[model samples]
Target: MGVFLETSRLVLRPFGAGDVDLLVALDGDPAVMRFINGGRPTSREAVEARVLPRLLRDYPWGTRGYWAAEEKGGGGFLGWFEFRPVEAENPAVVELGYRLNRSAWGRGYATEGSRALIHKGFTDLGVERVTANTMAVNTGSRRVMEKSGLTLVRHFTGDWPERIEGSEHGEVEYALTRSRWERTRQPPAAPRP
Candidate 1:
């Protein structure tokens, strides 16, 4: 029952065995999965057998893995966030990602939570860089990344196994280095006296 982190409006905690249904419902939303799995809902078997196991196993990453985001006051499930290594990439360089319910869309939860995680990663955690990727057509997600102080680093095509509707447009990567993030947090120069 490790609590990873929390923002003003959200609490990010670890997912447990009992959270399978939540993941299932979140993944089942077509609007939520529009870009992720091409609007294909995730099966219960996959959630129970594969997804839960993977999430449970990821707990060992300490504070750097997947987290279940919930409302602090109402305890409502918003979605999940991941701040971890980019699979074999530099350990100091973590990746920031999130999947929130379509109902939570349009609100500033995504940007708020992401900025908090980025601050934690650069300050409390040993992260030197943070990266995020999304379909080029996912302007909402791209805007969140930008609001979190990340800049467009690259745009490239992935060898995706499935050809989704917007896959032809390619993917985009956004990144923010610790130095850059720190600069954003620094207070402006004192009045030149």
Candidate 2:
């Protein structure tokens, strides 16, 4: 009984306790979790004890949280998308991210889900900006970020615990401000402001 946002091929909906199975299945896929965990599987206990709790905690801060993305026609769970604020001190901003089953790749679900979330941020959530980050070698995610209208903000290097292959060149952040999003949403430009 939560609200759902529908794109042409996917639907984004609120998370529920019943989603543990879906999370396990998604995290179990070696191909899906390759870059994230070096193909290691995530245990259900870890997801239940730590991941889900942290994911849902953002609800109190803002209208930003993870969502379950499903195929509109079949109702199959593709994966999840996150539109949550990066909880930190001082001014904060929302971040966009997604994780899909291997079957969901090359199907445009990432782009569709991301675009819907970006629009929801600016229009419904009053978010002034949205950003996304991925490993520098993560071309697929970077592509989704750019296709969703975010420009490269910076490249960040972190001491990742897993140390995947692409972690070397560092991670990149992409962002889109409200004004930039508004411009992309418009039909045609009349004149400069």
Candidate 3:
């Protein structure tokens, strides 16, 4: 598959079968998986059987649900991003998500990629709404969602199979609707005289 989207510094491309090692290495980092699975390192067997299958699946609209994020200049795998519909058959509402290596953190990559994906969702993908969720304690993720123009929609506990460190505090949902996005979009600057 070809590149799904691109920002000035990142390229989002569809994942391939050859990308298993990248996923394994990414999920092996404890800090990266802290909130995801309480720092448990995922086995290659799991990634091959469970994780990769989900990422490689195509949606009803003919687009893959997940994309591998890479640095534009270096072409290094950063992580993956999710922009799949909430319902399998509907394209109206899609879930937005990302999982980047710790080295990619604090560099504004998350915010940059997120804003671009949200823009693509509303402007080109016929998406009516974009939603994201993270543990309430994850202030960094929350900030990225806010920076991408999503606002807090709800806070609720999820029925996860396993409890993590911050599960007690619950989770939060942030969202932006196409109408709100249109109203808040900044117009292009006027040409200088």
Candidate 4:
């Protein structure tokens, strides 16, 4: 399998046909699905029919897409990370997202992977902006975004298809522009002649 990115403790790679079971199990966990689908488990049929196909075709314009995150030491599947365009109409701006197993929570895997991808986006991919959104009550994800250098850009309600527990609190969006990201890592190589 081709690796997309790497961190100190994790390796991010593209999903393969063999990853269907893994994806199903990850989305099946209630705790994992709590914030995402109100604790509803994704069915195997759905994973095979819709989800996997969608993820496979997701990356067209950007170098980054949905990647499976595995631990480097034991080579276990931790979760997946997405670094892709926020909208099909806009390729300059990318979105950062992650979904980890409940066992992998609180261990900084999310933040570490996110930080690495953000760095690559700014320094390698020429991405203009990176954005992320989460439920307002998802403090864990918000903390990860903050640690990854994304600042709160907006807070507004969304028209979600399903009613979730924390939907009432609305959602928050975090973003970092290439200019802001570069400033944080200033004093780089000389400008292109």
The 10 consecutive residues of candidate 1 with the worst lDDT sum are 184-193
Give me candidate 3's TM-score against the actual structure.
0.94
Each model's lDDT comes to 0.83, 0.79, 0.90, 0.85
Q: Which scores higher on TM-score, 1 or 4?
A: 4
Query: Which prediction has the highest lDDT against the true structure?
Result: 3
Q: What lDDT, from 0 to 1, does candidate 4 have?
A: 0.85
lDDT of 2 at 156: 85
lDDT of 4 by residue, 1-193 (tens): 4777777788888888899999999999999999898999999999999978766765555444788899986689998998888776566799899999999998888888888888887877768999999999999999989888899999999998999999999999999999988788522122123
Q: Return the clash pairs for model 2, or none.
A: none
In candidate 1, position 121 carries an lDDT of 79
* Count of residue pairs whose backbone atoms collide, per candidate: 0, 0, 0, 0
List the candidate 1 regions with Cα displacement exceeding 4 Å.
59-61, 87-90, 186-193
lDDT of 4 at 138: 95
For 65-173, candidate 3 gives per-residue lDDT tens digits of: 8999998876799999999999999999999999999999988788878888888888888999999999999999999898788999999999989999999999999
Q: After superposition, how far is residue 17 of candidate 1 from its true place, in Å?
A: 0.4
Q: How far off is residue 92 in model 4, in Å?
A: 1.1
lDDT of 2 by residue, 1-193 (tens): 4656877678777777788888889998888887787888999999898777765554544443888899887779999998887654312378899999888887778887888888877887767889888888889999988878889999889879868776788989999999988877732112123
Report the Cα lDDT for candidate 3.
Answer: 0.90
Candidate 3 residue runs with Cα over 4 Å from true position:
186-193
